[model samples]
Target: MTAPVLEMRSIVKTFPGVRALSDVSLTVAPGEVHAICGENGAGKSTLMKVLSGVHPYGSYEGEILFEGSPCAFRDIRASEAQGIVIIHQELALIPYLSIAENIFLGNEHATRGFINWNDTLRHAASLLKRVGLDEHPQTRVADIGVGKQQLVEIAKALAKRVKLLILDEPTAALNDGDSAQLLRLIGELKEQGITSIIISHKLNEIAEVADSVTILRDGRTIETLDVKAGSTTEDRIIRGMVGRDLDHRFPERTPYEGDPGAHPALEVRDWTVHHPIDQQRKVVDGVSVQVRRGEIVGIAGLMGAGRTELAMSVFGRSYGRNISGTVLKDGREIGTRTVPEAVAHGIAYVTEDRKQYGLNLIDTIGRNITLSALSKVARRGVVDEHEETRVAESYRGSMNIKAPTVFEQVGRLSGGNQQKVVLSKWIFAGPDVLILDEPTRGIDVGAKYEIYTVIDRLAAEGKAVIFISSELPELLGMCDRVYTMAAGRLTGEIPRAEATQEVLMRHMTKNTR
Candidate 1:
């Protein structure tokens, strides 16, 4: 029998007032794709962090063995020195730097205290080619799309001569084509005798590429299953992570009564938004959409299809330039030219990039939750701290935000919990129309169901919801009606009964110039 490449035994890591990991163990064989499956806050990422020395040696109690040798790494650089490279969920490349520069930022091609540009670009070009990224090494990283950025991240890892490559939510920001290319690259790397440990919530991707699967729940190792033995089904893995079989992926919603056209809760007409920098380029071309009271409408499209642009433009002219749109609420025109006006007009938008645009990372959960509507918790023009706490506590309970207290920092919470806080903030604002953009992105299956349930409940409460997602099944499962977009144009609209992956793909790829 071949010896294991990596082994982590009895790892325990903790934060203030929270135990992130507890006596968790993982084993990875040489040249095998190992997958770590878990729900949000399950310590999947924490375990990898410990292995990569992000937590250091003394910060966590654990025994790590690499290539049958006991290892004690103090920092990320120490781990990288031993051919262990970790690509975090958030890509670490600097946007302003060139691709080659970003790839070898810290590990530069230098000789005798002098940098070698020739060797750097040459090696970066080769690495980019190996990763199937067809781009000039000197190209500015900011100019490229997210899919390319992901490739750049991999190329960066490969530059380190990585033996045990660790990727956390690598495909979270990628579209289908990009995701497929990434997975194929992983397979190629496996063939080359490189071991990989991938941590992701996308179970299909896990089932597709993983050789062995380790399940973690609430800071403990549940079990590890061998994929080749036909034991790692998506549902089975989900059951292990969530500790129960999820009978339904999405919550059932009561059908909206009456003709949807009879009472349009929110409507956008002749909406066209130009690119922010490139004024002549229209990101969101002449498009119009309507949502009725008590209806959950969905926008399904590929990356760069302008779904987010459309929603942002409609919400508060948040994106794009040269915007021309008329927003109507209950047959009355409303001014949504600014964020404050949009909110006052009963329109709330939950952004896809929660860490970036959704929440104040340094602030408390209570503060972030009540940020959108402070007036409700204010008295005599003074912010009432007790009322704010009460309101935030109410949302924390209803939204299922898993935090010890409302005083916990928002950044300290998991992706799903942070998302719930974002939802809570907007819902507290008491909006008649809510726009949820990739609300469940990077979240686990269990959290997704909760988010879906919240959306359904909002629709039931007579709130019009415009749900935008890149996942076709999510759209088909939770949406009452799904609209497809391509090239900034509405391609097709399919009702729940008529929607399928095949049909949605057809419309999503439709050339609607």
Candidate 2:
């Protein structure tokens, strides 16, 4: 290839306890869509941060040459000045601001410190049209869905006159249609000679749009394949990323065939929870479920299936109003309806939205881990700080929560590490029944393996585990029995041996009003 548009040679970066990247090299040709594929903690984000000046010039040892000229960008603005823009996996958008305002936030069009509203609206509107976002510029960003917000982020990068755009897990939050649209836009950008890099875990997307693919494993570059050279295969890429073929993404499960109608460890009878809003309808319809000890029960459905609503409502009625549910444990009903009541009764919930509802971001990892079970380490309504620290430190080590110290803020950790904290918090609650929602959602492959082992161990310990996930493969692998839901109703229940994606998807899409 001729001189590439962007090149990074021998990039090396290390944290206190983690070597994030080592000898990573990449070259992106002008107008090409190069993909960086790796399991979680594969150093993809770290490398991109170095390239985009988030790490600055000296923090990491590397040589970044843009358009065949050596470059040093001290900050993100300096990199953008040279037409390189990066959209992080976690979006950086002002929720209350109008779409136009968010798009041109830092680089607003103004005169003498006075904003030019007309020009701003016209420019933002035109950019939105290019990205196929039909929403008005005046609309608040918070009002839009995740997919629309992603398109706006892209349009914002376009406003920066991006020459090389970096998107990190851009479609992680998007639905099927939005993901396709974003990929199409990249193709269109390529035609315009704007170089791009897309980082994603979804191998199908990589196969569709990537001109070249680089695989990073354990903070090292393993291989880079030329997709146009007829050597690219999804299997090959998976091997490079995880160092083995995941011939079977789902682990095999044995059927749990004890006596039917046996006493279940956790049971919800005729459960119902209404929306908190006045005149609101029931979010969770009359539903019922029974999970036996030492069983992993799976809930399968498409988005808004009310699976999560059902779980949260049952977990001490944390989600809704007018909640009427008879929660039975060991053949006896508990006359309790509070979060602590559930926890005290040996029922713990690990939420899907870990960031917002699970973790206290401002607190240290140690504190966050012990938050749920603070009373366990207290004496006469006073917490024993030493015991709390000891318990938190143990979970950090056992959960493999990577951090410089236990005192590190939970928010500063990566998505996977933060999730470990959430799991630790709930586990400390000493729950015999654990409600897990999307337990491995944003975590990396290596971390995912560890988490899988943890869940299996929990099942082995005879805990009634409710495993909820969007990925059907995980449900098939992990759950002892699978239950499918559609539009707030239980559609079907299939034994693990008989469960299949086709069967689950059929129930997942069962339309109900």
Candidate 3:
């Protein structure tokens, strides 16, 4: 047997009131694709941060061995110097910079403190080619799609001459096709004898690509399964992560049978939105959608199909230019020309990009939850601190936020907890029509189930929900009626009884006149 490439022994990491990891240990074999599986807040990211030196040495109790040698890295640079590179779940690339500039941001091709543009571009071009990206090296990062941006991140890692690569939810934001391509790229990297440690909530992907799996639960290492041994199915992984057998991926709900005479809770008439940058291009072309009370309506589409544009444009013109849309709530046309008006009219939009648009990470949890509806907790233009704390604490318990207190900064919470905070803010706003864009994007299975349960309860209380997701299975599993969009047009609509993956996909791909 060959020596392990990396080993972490008796690792312990803690925050002020929370022990993130407790006596956790992991071993990765050389040239193997190893997967770290756990529920959100189960210490996967914390362990990786420790390894990558994001937490630094002397801050935790652990003995790390790399290439059979004891090493304590003081920072990320020290780890990267030994050919280890970690790409975080939230991409670290600067949006304003060009692809070449982002690839060589810190590790530049320079001489005597002067950048060599020629050398940098030349090296970036080669790296981009190696990652199968065809975009020009000088193209702005913001102009490219998320899939391409992911490739750029990999190119950046390659520039460091990485021997061991760690990817944290690399495909969380990517569509299915992009995800497949990335998994293939991982396979290719494995073929080149590069060891990889991938942390992901997608069990199927882990089952497909991982050679060995490590399961962590409540900050403790449970067991490591050898995939080659043939007992490491996705269901098996879920059982380990959640500490019980999960018979179904989705919770059961009473189906919403459509009624022609019933009035919709929310409706859009002949909505159209031109592209924000290019006014000549119509992103959403004459699209119409409606959701009845106590129903969950799903929008299914490929990336760039303008599902997000439709949602944002309807929700107070948060996106696009030249937006011409008539929004009706309870059969009455409401004027939602701005965000405050939209909220006043009982409409809420939960953005897909939580970090950017959903919550204020620097603020306390209580503050973020009260942000959308401060008027409720305010008296005479003064915030009622006691009332605010009471409301926030109520939601923290009801929504299962999992934070120590409402005083904790939202940025310190896990992805699942942050999403709960976003949901809590809007739910507190008391919107009759709620648009949830990719609500379960990067969360784990356990957290997803919790969110789904909350959505189901909301619908049971007669709140109309607009659920948009890149994952078709999620739509098929949760929606009462599914609306398919392609090329910025509403291609088809299917009832839950009639909706299947095949039907939704066909409609999603069909061209509209």
Cα lDDT tens digits for candidate 3, 302-391: 998999999888888999999897888889999888999999999999999999999999999999999999999999999999999999
What stretches of model 1 exceed 4 Å from their correct place?
259-261
> Candidate 1's residue-wise lDDT over 157-241, tens digit each?
8999999999999999999999999999999999988999999999999889999899999999999999878866899999999
TM-score of candidate 2 on Cα atoms, chains taken together: 0.92
- Top candidate by lDDT: 3
What is the C-alpha local distance difference test score of each model?
0.92, 0.87, 0.94
Q: What's the distance in Å from true for residue 156, model 2?
A: 1.4
Worst 10 residues of 1 by lDDT: 254-263
Better of 1 and 3 by lDDT: 3
Clashing pairs in 2: 40-444
**Candidate scoring better on lDDT of 1 and 2:** 1
TM for every model, in the order presented, reads 0.98, 0.92, 0.98
Considering summed lDDT, which 10 consecutive residues are worst modelled in model 3?
254-263
